[model samples]
Target: MKALRRPSTAVNALLALLIVGAAFWGWTLLKDTDSDTGANASGLRTLTVEQGTVTKTVEADGSVESASTATATFGTAGTVTAIKVKVGDKVTSGQLLARVDDTGAARSLDLAEANLDAAEDALGRAQDAGTDTSSATNEVAQAELAVDEAEAAVAGTKLTAPMAGTVTAVNGTLGGSSSGAEGSGFLDIADLGKLQITAAFSEADATELKEGQAATVTWNALQGAETTGQVVAVDPTATTDDSVVTYGVTVSLPNPPDGAKPGQTVTVSVITGNVENAVLINSAAVTTTGNRHVVTVVGTGNQQETRQVQVGLEGDDAYQITSGLTAGERVVIPTSTTTSSTSNSNNSGPGGFMGGGGGAPPGGR
Candidate 1:
């Protein structure tokens, strides 16, 4: 019965057509996969090495602040009698700022002087009568000390500026108690001419910072406003917050633009390294191999060769090629996507090419 079923010609012809269609479909899939591989290989990017300047910089956010500031307050507490300076008044050091009532201080000074005169007369009388004068002499010395303290108390009634600056605040007013302005003092002054920028940089970035390093500052409030500054100080200790550590850096702006004021936000860029007339190439084209830097250079006829290169200044975008590469040469930038796909096809563990236990690939620096 099974042998009788092979006599049908129509069924055999249909089977032949089905087999052909299956083979064609299989061929199309294989062709597509090959095409995809070719496209990915052709997508490799290349760059031409050239001579230029490479600069390495560290950027941070900061705020403008006054370099020097002072606060003036009265030395003695009394009724505020007068205020000599107002807010925005420019005054020099030792200038009187305000005065307090000194009636009690002056009375104490007069009484102390009278007591000292009486004690001295008693000491002279003791010596003339040939009696021990030690007790009388001690009384005269104590009276003299009281007089000096009373004089100091009277002088303390006047509040004066400790430094030359424009008065930014005035807390005292006529007839007010001097004790009322204890917290902020009677006046606050700042030297606005000397401006500085205070910025916090990550511990990793702060290692390259030092005093006297040049910096460029850009104001966030003012468009197109910028100025040059110098690094005046770097904190010796790190400040930690939420487990993140940073260092405080102070930059002095010698010539600030007009309208620049304290508390304004700014961006600071410090040039850490610079090289001129050096052979440079895109950092993406270089890869680290063990202890050497390797690059894929494309030569004539589209041939490629991997060679070791000596990298000098590792800039933000480009690398300074010190040797093993000349200007006008083309270097290939390895495409991660293609490399990753090839690695997966071979059943390589979780990481892709130059990944896993391997070191960093191109552009890692």
Candidate 2:
């Protein structure tokens, strides 16, 4: 048989061209994928530093409380004979809230009166006989003292409101035992004339607070409703619970809205300090390096320079950059795009589509 005809050069050239074309196509596809994954990408995200007022605040949560409260109880223990007040009753000072048994007080008063009469008779007899009446006079004075004591005991049996307020609780019942303690009080009165918020702050935050500092209180139950207040008191003593020490802070709400009741949860933000016309940046843009805080600054040519930063009055998410950065300078931060790319890469395997090989932009996440 004739020797197998070798493929011609023209045919070979076409086959070579097809193979090279396929290789080039595959390489282009890979290049496109790498670009999409942000590998060696030129796009960079930057934030424009701004100048504004930055306020340093201490945030705390606490419950609304009355400015003053009074729990009325008997000074002496006795059988509860009557309850003169009920919950929600508005009372004035000296108003009777309850009454206890006064039978013993009555008997004591009668005995004292009989003694006084006998002493007076003896005194008259001594005067008539022209003997010394000093002993009889002393006896009469003693009897008068006993009578006053008996009268005070009778008054003590009545529980009276110490101040004008609304009765919040009544714990006394007819014929019930009264012990003059909290749970056995005849009534509980809360002075609703002025409202206040009591919050506890950590020792570190409490140090920054002082009396007369401005505060903003937002009631959780009343949406969009807030009241202005001032720091009235900061207890020098710290209260410790569960190994956590917190200082008590009292905020006075001079004009709390109606319907704001005691025991309502509230959030308070106390303005500790404020800097006007200060360079500010996002707090997250800061990164710690060695002993100093630093931020990546992006220059006009997209060149990055890590510079040391001096910060002051750090707020919730913004920071007062005192030095090392100025207004209008662009600083690199972890952009939302970079975050999305990283999240996608994490969920999708390396071979998966949309592979973010690099995952972040330069100086970004």
> TM-score of every model?
0.75, 0.74
Model 2 C-alpha lDDT versus the unseen true structure: 0.76
Q: Each prediction's Cα RMSD?
A: 12.1, 10.0
lDDT against true structure, model 1: 0.80
lDDT of each: 0.80, 0.76
lDDT of 2 by residue, 146-213 (tens): 88887888888888899999998877677887654445566789988778999999999999999999
Residue ranges of candidate 2 with Cα displaced over 4 Å: 1-41, 120-141, 180-184, 289-291, 334-365
User: Model 1 segments beyond 4 Å from truth?
Assistant: 1-43, 171-183, 289-292, 337-365
lDDT of 1 by residue, 133-220 (tens): 9999999999999999999999999888899988888877799977546678778899989889999999998999999999999999
| Candidate with maximal lDDT | 1
- Per model, state how many residue pairs clash: 0, 0
